[model samples]
Every structure is written in C-alpha cells, then in structure tokens.
Target chain A: MIGGRPDMVDDEHRLKMLMVAGLGGDEAAYRAVLGALARHLRGFFRRRLASRPADCEDLVQETLLAVHTRRHTFDRSQPLTPWVFAIARYKLVDWLRRHARQDALHDPVDEWRNDLAVEGGQEADTARHDVSELLGTLPAKQREPIRLVKLEGLSVVEAAERTGLSVSAVKVGIHRGLKKLAAQFRP
Target chain B: MRTDDLVALLARGAGTEPMAVPARVWAMAVAGGAVAAVALMALMLGVQADLAGKVSTLAWWGKAGFTLAVALPALALITRMARPGSHVGRLPVALAAPVAALWLAAAIQLAGAPPGERLALVLGKTWASCPVWVTVLSLPLLIAALAALRALAPTRLALSGAGAGLFAGAVGALVYTLHCPELDPAFVAVWYVLGIAIPTGLGAAVGPWILRW
Candidate 1:
C-alpha cells in the first residue's frame, strides 16, 4: 500500500481513502496516508527546531495529534500537502509559545503567574535556555506575533481586535513569522 | 533519534490521552434523529393530504422543484447545525437511517411513473422520500459545525442550536434559490419552507438536548 502505489495518483483517491476509510475507522489506511505527512512534518519541525533537539519529539507528537483531530477538514478533492502544512504551521506556532513561557487561557492565570514570577532559580534558567534556543529557531518578528497570538491564546479576530490591526495583517504576521522560522534552519 | 526510530517510537508508543468515547451520547443522537425523522414525516404527510386536491393546479416542475428546494436546504441546515466534535456527530448518521428508508420508498413510487405521473406519486410519498439524502449528507456537515463549536464551549443548547438553525436557514435558502424551479412562490413558500424548516428545527431543538455530551 505504501511504495506500490504511484506517488502522483489523483487527489480524489487520496480523499476517498481519507473519507471512506479514514473516517470509517480503517487504521491501516489512516497510517499509510499519515506516514507521508509525518516525514513532511518532521522536515518542517527540523528546520525550525535545529537548535532545540530536546523539543523536536514533543513538537512532532503535538502536531500529529492535531493532524489526527483536524483530519476531517482536509477536503478530499484538494492537494494534501498544503492542508497538512497548514496544520503543522499552526502546531509549530503553538509549540514556540509554550516554550517561551507565554500564558495560554487554558492555563490558570494564578498558577502561571506564580510559576514564572516566583520560580526564578537555576531550574527556570535551564528551561528558559531550552525555550530561548527554540525561539532562536525563528526570527524575532515571527516569534513576537506567535507569542502574542498563539502563546497568548488570542483568536485571530481578538489579536487583530486588540492590536488595532486588520485581521489580514495579523494573518500576514503569522505567515511572515513562519517564513522567518523556516529561514532560520534552511541548511 | 533517527527519523525511522522516532517514527516507530511514536507509532508504537502509548498515547498519553484517553480513548474514552461517551456511549450514552451516541445513543441519544441516534434516538433524536429518529424522533426528528418521524415528526418530519408526519408533517409532510399532513401537507400531502391538504395538497392532494390541488395537485393538477400546480405545474409539474413546480411540484417537484418545490419538494427539492425544500429538501436540499432543510437537509443542509440540519447537517450543518449538528456539530462534529460533540456526541451529536452520530445524529446525522442516525437520521440517515430514516431518510434512506424514505428515499427508497420515493424511488419505488417514482419508478414506473412518467414525468407527469411523478407529481402525484410524490404528493403521496413526498413526506417519505426526501428526508433520506438530506439526512445522509448532513452527517458530515454536522461534524464540521460541531468542530467549530467545540472551542466555543457554549453553555446553552438553545444558543448552539440557534446557531445551527441560522446556518441551516441561510444555507437552505441559498441552495434552494439556486437549484429549485421558481414556478409558484406560493408552493415554494409552503412545502419548500417546510422541507427546510422541519429538519432544521429538529436539529436545533434536539441538537442541544442530545449533543450535550
């Protein structure tokens, strides 16, 4: 099922595989389709996570979970790569925020404030070092918007609403943020 | 770790998350869909008897298009209103069971009839046939709508079902406007409106109560 099929098969079959089998609970089919995605996603994270080897596995796991959860959104008729990467892009930004010690709404504000403000010892320093190294994976512009939006748990509308910028501009900020992250580890 | 190693590790490694699916939630969805289908069938049958005397008064396309226009939007809205991520995901699929049965009945009625004869058959069986495909296609749309709702964590079913109803209304109206014949706005206004309204209302009314899980 893997190498036997031609790589350039029509998008319809891929979508059918996803919809009929994937939605219908064919685990083998799900794995086969997602296997290619794993490689592509790994490459994406590798480029953004070169300096933060420790975080790569966690990032990849989180991204795959998202892909599994949101797989239905992939219109069966469209090319698979862009959809996969869009999810990957979102996951990557989410990881970067977690690394940077940003507050997410899901996290209790009091606990988060206590963890960041009070725990300022060597343990915090090492964790910060790892996160900052990951941050170094993306340029500052990319990191800043991600920190504000994803890490801060702001919706695109909310981010724009708060920043007094257009929603399109916020999306552009996220896009440019990714491009800059991609540029950091293009070797 | 090697890429292969990582892949294998993640592939085999135990998922830290739970795989628990709420059983009662799915049961309620299936049950609600059944109730909605039955209620809709009753409503349509009532309309058929009322319209039987006037079957020849309306044009052929007028009758069929009225049915279609109503069916398409109503189905779309019902499916759209059911959210994907919640327990209601199964509602569309469950609703499909009844709708499919109705479609089979309609197709059988339409089998030997000529175009002109078709209107009479539909008038007799319209209540039965139309809900099948509407319910079938709606399962997926319900899933998408629910996924969008998951993050919102709406506290009230009325709010969520209302959202689903509005979406169903708009989608139903738009789709009907495009494909259905505009013969008698009166016919369209009647059966077509029921076609859309019944399924949508069913989804909305039941969506919150059943999908609460």
Candidate 2:
C-alpha cells in the first residue's frame, strides 16, 4: 500500500537505488540521497513543528545525521521512503518530548513570523550570530575546531592544519564541542 | 552548522566498507550471549545428572522445543525492530503459539491428574528455583542483545528492548534446561513463563533510558 501510486513508486525506487549505491561507498550517491532526504525531512518536520517552526531545521539536521549514521540498518529489499520517514518521525518525537514544556510558552504569532524570516535571507545572519555566540561559550580547544570544521565548512584535515592540532584532535574537538552544544539545548 | 554542510560532512565520512549486516550482528550477539549464559549456568548449577537418559525423553524435547519456538519468533521480531518502518506482522502470533500450545498441554496434564496432584504438577520439585535461575541466566544475554540493538537503529525503543528481553528469556530458558530436571508441562508453562516475563518487564522499563541514541 505504501508505494501504490505511480509517483510514489518512482520516488521510492529512485531513493532506494541511491541508498543502495551509497551503502556501497558511492560518495556522490550518498550525498545525493542525503540531499534528497533533507528536502523531504524539512517539509516533514515543518508541518509537525508548526508551533515551534524555528526548531524544524534543527530536527531535519538531526534526522539526516541519524539516517547517515544508521544507514546500515536499511534493508535494501524495503522501500527507502518509509525508512527515511521513520527516522524523521523518531527525531520529531524525540524533539517534541524534549521540548514538551516549551510548547505552552511559545507565541504562535511570533513563531509564524520567525518561520517566514527563516525562509528569507535575513534570518541566516541571526542564526549565524546565535551559533557563534554559542561557540564562544565553549572552551577554545573545543570552539576552534567546531568553528573551523563545522561553521567554516573546513574538512577535518584543514581544521587540524589551521588549529595546529592533529587530525584526531580536531575530530575529537568537534565531537566534544557538538556534544556540549547539544547539552546546552537540554533543560 | 547548516544542514547542507552537515550532509556533506556525513557523506565524506561514509566508510569504504559498509557495516556488518544485521543478521551477522544478531548472530554474534546471540552466540556470544549463549556462550556466556552456558558458562554461567555451568558455574552456578551443573547439568542434570541423567543426561543420557533424559535425551530420549518426551519431556526434554517438549521443554527444548517450547523454548526454541519462542526464541525463533523473538529473534525474528527483534531483527525487524532493528530496521525502521519494517512491519512486525504475525510475529507476535508466532511468539504466542508455543506458549499457547504449552498451556494447552499443561491444562490437559492438570486435568488428567488427581485432585491433590494438580498443585504438584504445576509446582514441580524445583518450581521456586526454576524461574529465578532462568531470570538470573537471562542477564548476560539481555546485556549482549541490548548492546547489539544499540549498534543498530531501533525507532521503537521499548518494543525493541522487549523483543531483546523476550529473545534473551527464551534463550536463557533454553540454557536453563541443561541443568533443570523438572519435566512437567505445567511446571514449564508456569515457572518458565514467569522467568521470561521478568526480563521482558525489565527490558521495557529500562528501554526508554538505555535505548536512547
């Protein structure tokens, strides 16, 4: 019943092919799959998180990462969209659970405007500023690597070179920095 | 970081080799846990004395068959849970079949027995220790199975944990059969079920916490 429609079948087939190729170490296919999943997940979360629209992108990113890390769990025989949607749903449930208390506090009008602003270019600047402010709170060792590798879009090796740290250290810094950043979001 | 950048990084990090298949992972977990449980059983309680004599008996086969039946379905369910959006259709029914059959056998056995012997049939010589030992033995398998589930993605955390626990319980009961001498269908239907239930409850209780990714 899932892919009964022609369009749905095509979408499922295409995503499944890309995913299978991605599992076989095809970087382009993997990137393609991730990009495609991101678009779907953004819409998926936006609809569910309408009251907390600002959190939609964060949930999309989280679900995408989860899908990437848990890629091995995908059974090739199964349809890809369901698997992707399941992960998206799990992330949505988790986010909702975590932010349950904040639900009542959010102003619907403000959130609607925020959602529109995020669609516009100006919100990107505010997001970047907010992210930098968060990075500033981390220790220099953790901050520098995340700022370089994540925020600045540098590879681990490049971040290592810039920070004068070993590649492993840079990776560790990013890992720890992300963990700290995530912890800050928790109550 | 932006979502696009995150995807690019993840794509870059995708290893040349895919992870071991789910079947292989589950096999290793079950095998490893079985070995640990067997070892623990041997250390705590030696195998039943009439080993050669019991092999040909109907009770022995019944006990083993029941445990195996439960284990197989539990295994199937747990594997399904490891994947997202996979249907667990008919698995719960499969898992219940053996239990229902055993209960039927137990009922017949109890009915045929004399009034005074009914309680005795249900409560065999080792009734008190059987479930306890079975639960104790399930610990290692539960740990190993949970670890395996953790390595894979399980969207339904509590269900996955319950599946793992059910698998562990069935396997643990299978391992317990090595040392247990009781053979009454009533005893197995009651005590063994209790033993398996303990871990299933434990798994469900802790699932939301431990299975959090």
Q: Evaluate every candidate with DockQ and list the scores.
A: 0.04, 0.41
How much does candidate 1 score in TM-score?
0.33
Kindly list the per-residue Cα lDDT of model 1 for residues B90-143, writing each as its tens digit. Answer: 444543453444455456546656778766544443444333334432343344
TM, chain A, every candidate: 0.43, 0.62
* Model 1 / residue A101 / CA error / Å: 14
Q: Compute the interface RMSD for each candidate structure.
A: 13.2, 4.1
**Which stretches in model 1 have alpha-carbon errors above 4 Å?**
A1-36, A42-59, A66-78, A89-187, B1-6, B9-35, B38-49, B54-213
User: Per-residue lDDT tens digits of candidate 2, residues B1-213?
Assistant: 576776776676353444567878888999999999999999989888897788799999999999999999999988889888988999989998999999999999999999998998898899999989999999999999899988777889999999989999999999999999989999999999999999998888887778776
Instruction: Give every collision pair in model 2.
Output: none
- In terms of lDDT, the poorest run of 10 residues in model 1 chain B is B13-22
lDDT of 1 by residue, A96-138 (tens): 6555564454467776566566345422112222223545566
Error of 2 at B185 (Å): 0.4
